[model samples]
Target: MWHPGLVDVVYATVAGALLSTAVVAARAGSPHRTPSRTALVAAVGTLGVSFLVQSPAARGVQNHLVADLGQLTGNGTSLVAAYALRVMVLHVRYDRDTAAARARRWLVALVVAFVAMTVLFLATPTVPGRFTSPDAPAGVVAYYLIFTSYLGATLVSLALLLGRYLDTAGGRWSRLSLHLHRAACVAGLIYLAGRVVALLVGRPRLEGSGQRFNLIELGVTILMPAVVAVLFLLGVLIGRGERWLRHRRAYRRLRPLWEAARAARPHAVLPVTGGGARLRLYRRIIEIQDAQLAAAQVLDAAQRRRIDGAIAGAALTGESAAAVREAALLAAGLAVLRDGRAAGGDGGPVTGAADQEVDLSAAVARLERVSAAWTGSPVVHRLAAPPEPANPR
Candidate 1:
């Protein structure tokens, strides 16, 4: 038998996950609003609110009016959520004309189901604080049948739609999100099936004729929804999560070059603050650029020629070549600064003309390569190292 406390925890967790997913999806921006995006946000938000109302603590409230209201609201909102999900999937899988035509029919069906369920809920003779029970009245049974049928059909349609999309998904995150959404749909179907079985069989009876807890029923009611909610949440956030991870990796990779530049000319580092991984990385790049400019003041023509020769001899191409060339020059500049050999000459171009014209993403890519060469490339290390002097006896 499942513990009551554990069931409550599971309910709370599912509610929280759904709510969080709704917020994340709503905040995920696009160039402009679309039917798919709007439906997705609405579906998750209503679903989350349904779970919150049906939560154990909410149901346990002392007021009978609040408890009855919660039951009706939960059922009503969940119907809306299921309808919204159907609309979302339609928009995603079909063109606007076809999707809108189909969505109107689904909307009519949703209205009929919701109205029927609400009527049954009101007609059912139930206790003041309880709407659903194992030995429910025929009206209550009819109410649940409508709820489960609508929800199950919606989940099945979503599963089919997502499965088709999964096959054509181009990106890694896109495939992963589709896979997760399909899994959530399957879980929702299982939850619906379990509810149907529970409604039919009622709770198990103990030898003493007392009510016996059913683990399968508890799992279906509590754990299954949690699984569905978490999977859906993951699907919605997978793209953002992957992008954040990529930015973080880039930020870490650029640290070596960033540190070297900042250490050579501390004053060149910017005082800007308060940003996420991507923003911090942008600021770091700007600081490194400023440091390059500061070190350029000391770098002489002879050092630039030597660095250029070393880079050309390395036979690197594309960004690799650019990075090595930049690394060599920056190393030379830092050396000149340390040796107090401040030529104060016009250092000319510290980077290739092409480098200055690249976008922020390309600049970051090149800088990441520079960071790798700053500490790892043998040619860069050899060129950057100071010349060894020989003493005659």
Candidate 2:
């Protein structure tokens, strides 16, 4: 006996998550609009809708309306495949003029195919029931043919596109995305192929064979939705993992400066309690700013001039020179604080630039480079190191 309970619930949940995530991603990219972005989002969102409506939890009534919706949802899946193909084409060749013409041809084929499928669905005498039901009439064969062919083409195109993407993709996040895309496409193909075969072979013989091959049948029914769920969950996990890695990396790179600041001026330490990555990163930024302010009080003109001269003379150039100079200056300031002496009286307090935009990733990237030389720089050793204790007074 085939019960739809588990598969339906799983489908609904996974579909809901995929849709929600895509929506959030789209909204975040509101400033950048492109035809490819629109196609990809629509494709994904339509597939989500197809899954959502067919779920057993959503089939509240077994009336003709509900059954028609189920059938219509099948077509939605085909439409999704069409749009997915278009998305792939656009991704590979983003030329608007040429892509628009090609996309229109695809769209027209999809519409014509959809119309044919819809007409067959209405004319067919399918029992108002779950997708796996054996009560479908002869006309259902035509419906499955149209549905399966379009869906198969879409999946094939998607798989090919993902293969290309995987070849070009570098780093962890891009690899993760490609893996999920391929896995999902494979699962979709298996599910659609099974439906096509089941329809062609007729239900009575299929049910009889199911008794002998119970495990395969069970796998076919249960594993489709399960794979889809895994795909969605993997995407969410990878995204979160990427973010955590970035935050931790940034935090670690800034640690040397943060430690030095805390030692030289304890008052610069912020009263930060427990928090997530973003909050912790923010507090660390604030504390570092406070340390810079405190160091500025004792940092004198001669030391500043000397650091400037060293910066001008350093072998490094361009952005590297600028970044190294900042690190060297901060190091010198720390030394002055540590020694409790300077060539002259304190300069006025320094603070974070009010006019400058603070990009966390960019800041972290610069600091990571600076960290490579922070402890070893000769200027830092000369200026920031604590004065040796005099012979016992």
Candidate 3:
């Protein structure tokens, strides 16, 4: 008696998008392929299929077909869990023979479970568009056996994944893998638990024309897909998010050097690019390098000596020294340029050696360091300070 609604449409849309993004991500050259990535892609693809089958659009006809597909989707969870376990064991460097033996045993179990689910669903037709209640007693029993067993298996796999993650040492791959595995595990557990609860307690009472519907099943159907989709998408984005923040921070840090150089030679600055952090960072690097080159042409020997003295006086070392030295020199150059312009001296480029290639990465890192210490740097403060009037002569 259930009907397709807005919730089903929304779930389908989101699931479709998630599946598409996963497919794109999975398309690395074959050289980059790994068992873990392959299994994850398969899991996401199979989950998308489940979303499609459960969607309102697929409900009007072919009830048996949809039921079979649903059973198959449970196997997808098993596949992902098996591969995740394999990855974890490999990461921990378990003895190869033992690991392979354990993996083979699990694979056999997974195949048996999949086969059992398929056979059971084929034997009993699902009540079209109604998962909570089936017309026959056999159908009811089949439903519970297939789902609860699958759910129990899934829960075990997820527990293993979580436990391994917690026990293992930390690394970039470990963190990213944990994020992906954790989201998938949490989403699957929630959906599976909800279904089990509904199956146990959502009984129907005979009424005049029909039976009382299970509200729990209805809510679960409407909500689970959306929740899972969002979490999965977030897991995919975690690494990208960290990279973006890093690049953006570096871009902002270089603002002081870029601004000072641009002031002396505005034409050196390039037009800003649009879109994400990576594009902007690339443009920032190019423009900052260009500005430095232009500024070098205008700086005189006397001004250069002053900047060198400021760098020596800064008395910094290591990465910090590299950053502060660049900032102090640039600040001194800006001061000299400003004074020259104020005194009616042309700020034109003076003949100098040809431009050398800039180390964009190092420059950006140093600039970021400079930005971090700008307010506190004595050299910067001195360069920026107004000249003291000569003592009364």
Q: What TM-score would you give candidate 3 relative to the actual structure?
A: 0.53
Model 2: how far is 38 from its true place, Å? 7.4
How do the predictions measure up, each by TM-score? 0.60, 0.63, 0.53
Alpha carbon lDDT of each predicted model:
0.76, 0.65, 0.57
Kindly list the per-residue Cα lDDT of model 3 for residues 1-393, writing each as its tens digit: 355677567757876875786686576333235555565566566566666655666544444556535434534553444444444444344565665676677567666766666676667665553444533345545655665565456556655766676577354744774566576657667776776655554344333434334454555656664676666666666655666677788887767666766776576667664656766776666665565444455455555466557767767667665555555545544555655643321243321122232544554665566666555677767755224335897
Which residue pairs in model 2 clash with each other? 335-384
Error of 3 at 69 (Å): 4.2
Error of 2 at 121 (Å): 1.4
Candidate 3 residues lying further than 4 Å off, grouped into runs, are 16-49, 64-116, 123-187, 197-213, 230-250, 259-273, 283-319, 326-366, 372-376, 380-393
Clashing pairs in 1: none
lDDT of 2 by residue, 17-116 (tens): 7688668656642333667767766666666776676566655443446465665764567476466656556656757877777777777878877888
Per-residue lDDT of model 1, residues 1-393, tens digit only? 556566667767777777787786566543346898899889988888888877766766623564365667777888899999999889988899999999999999999998998788777757753454466677877888999999889999989888887778776887898899899999988888877766676644433443343555567667788888889888878956776777788888888878887677776777756666666777787777776776677666766777778777878887787778788777777766656664654666666554563366677777888888888887788887435334778
Lowest lDDT sum, 10 consecutive residues, model 2, at: 348-357
Which of the two candidates, 2 or 3, achieves a greater lDDT against the reference? 2
**In angstroms, how far off is 133's CA in candidate 2?**
6.3
Best candidate according to lDDT: 1
Per-candidate total of colliding backbone pairs? 0, 1, 0
